[model samples]
Target: MLLKSITPRESEKIIKIDRFVFTTFANIEALEYELSLGIKKIEAINTNYYLKIGGNEERIAFEAKIYLEYLEHFSGLVEKIKAREPLSLSTLESTKIRKILIDSFSAKTKDWLLDSSRNATYYTKEFSIGGVVL
Candidate 1:
């Protein structure tokens, strides 16, 4: 007997994966404000990740850590730019910084998906169809 496999419907599957892109940008803005006020020591910045399936949501912790590291890297670049001249970045400079963050995060996420240990089970559950778990 050939058993058929069942997959989740489009509505049940993960509909959106949200990264803390804006949150990182906002934190960097706040950091710049503090620096302008002569604040040397700044608090750590954190990022978050979320997966949505219909009305359900799952918070991703491990991936958030990786994202936080990249956020810090971007923050360092901003600090360097600030140190050179306490002025806002030029249009070209802003574009380069945005590209760096986009490319770096894209590459990292691709690499992460390639790892065998990283599976959908992290945010999904096994479902049985006709007494068979697929």
Candidate 2:
């Protein structure tokens, strides 16, 4: 007779995303603003930038991309408001901005499970009566 040995195997998956490049001047400012919110700076800033938040590089890039897109989407409207010099928002424009704020809170990725692995387990129970196994 042979007894099988139980063993558990574990692994950690790390994904390293390629550094993101800022194309537009507004995107650079957006990046700076994002960094300021967290009081963070580029880890390696030479030809490109290396950014991470809570040790997640992908999240940093993902957020920057979203901010850039948001800025691009509303740039024209923003410029129009600014062009007035006084930069006053009409009731309609104010309502639109409020809607944007509401939408921003719901922004989330479809999948955030970046890493996973299969796991195994085993259990045993021992019985004894009057200092003798039964």
Candidate 3:
């Protein structure tokens, strides 16, 4: 997801968000925020985000579109949650849907990414889909 997820004030540089994958609606909101601020560009329908969480590749390749207007004001909305669904890293039997997003990384990797303000906010997920925190 590092490739798809981006920070809004990331170097004032424009990046393309070819595709985004969030199990929860919060992830969608977070992605919308970045795009609205021009932090990154969510690619069109023909193309999409490729996020292979572990061996979960099928669901990761799902298709979706990012509306033009939503990308225009993403910054304002990321702060205002749309969905709120609390979730777990794994489910009892639902493997088709994207599972809860638990940061799976070494302490060093997380520390390095968060210590720097340019990347600190990257680790902090926001919004939710009916309580499923993304």
Candidate 4:
């Protein structure tokens, strides 16, 4: 996926990937310079190292199964977002929507969002004026 093109503004950092929106107060020019290079796909592998002992095999297998399930769920979610599927806010509760918003961010951006001292704020009123309420 490519980073969506946006006009750089003072004191505002907005990055869009597919349907996800990431906002923060950081160096936008630096981010834009990084994106100007190119977008590269990075492959990640999850490995589990454990001793073949009593009960360990079962535990490792259970953990592996959970990890695979999570990967599958995340992959499907990404595909849906990339496809720009229609969102029905009326059918989804607030917590579920919040989870989707949080999951949309990249790991680093998500960390920033979760940081209590970051003082992040969502512009609900602005979004509402544009026809989106969340």
Weakest ten-residue segment in model 1 by summed lDDT: 125-134
lDDT (tens digit, per residue) of candidate 2 on 62-104: 1222232223332343233234332211121122211111111
For candidate 3, what's the RMSD?
19.0
Between candidates 1 and 3, the TM-score winner: 3
Better of 1 and 4 by lDDT: 4
- Per-model lDDT: 0.23, 0.22, 0.28, 0.26
Tell me the lDDT of candidate 4. 0.26
Model 3 vs. true fold: TM: 0.15
lDDT order, best first, reads 3, 4, 1, 2
- Cα TM-score per model: 0.14, 0.15, 0.15, 0.19
**Worst 10 contiguous positions by lDDT, candidate 4:** 56-65
Number of backbone clashes in candidate 2:
0
Q: Residue 133 of candidate 1: its Cα lDDT?
A: 8
- Quote the positional error of residue 109 for candidate 3 in Å: 18
**lDDT (C-alpha) at residue 111 in model 2:** 21
Q: Residue-wise lDDT of candidate 4 within 1-134, one digit each (tens)? A: 32223422323324332233323422222221111223334455775444333221100000011111122222343454455444322111122331112112221212123247777743111111011222
Clash pairs of candidate 1? none
Could you tell me how far off, in angstroms, the CA of residue 105 lies in candidate 2 after the best superposition?
Answer: 22
Candidate 1 on 1-134: residue-level lDDT in tens?
Answer: 31112222323212111111332212221111111222234345674444333432211111122232333323343343334322222121133211111111211322233247666322111111011000
Residue 110, model 2: Cα distance from true site in angstroms = 25
User: Which residue segments of model 4 deviate by more than 4 Å?
Assistant: 1-69, 89-104, 107-134
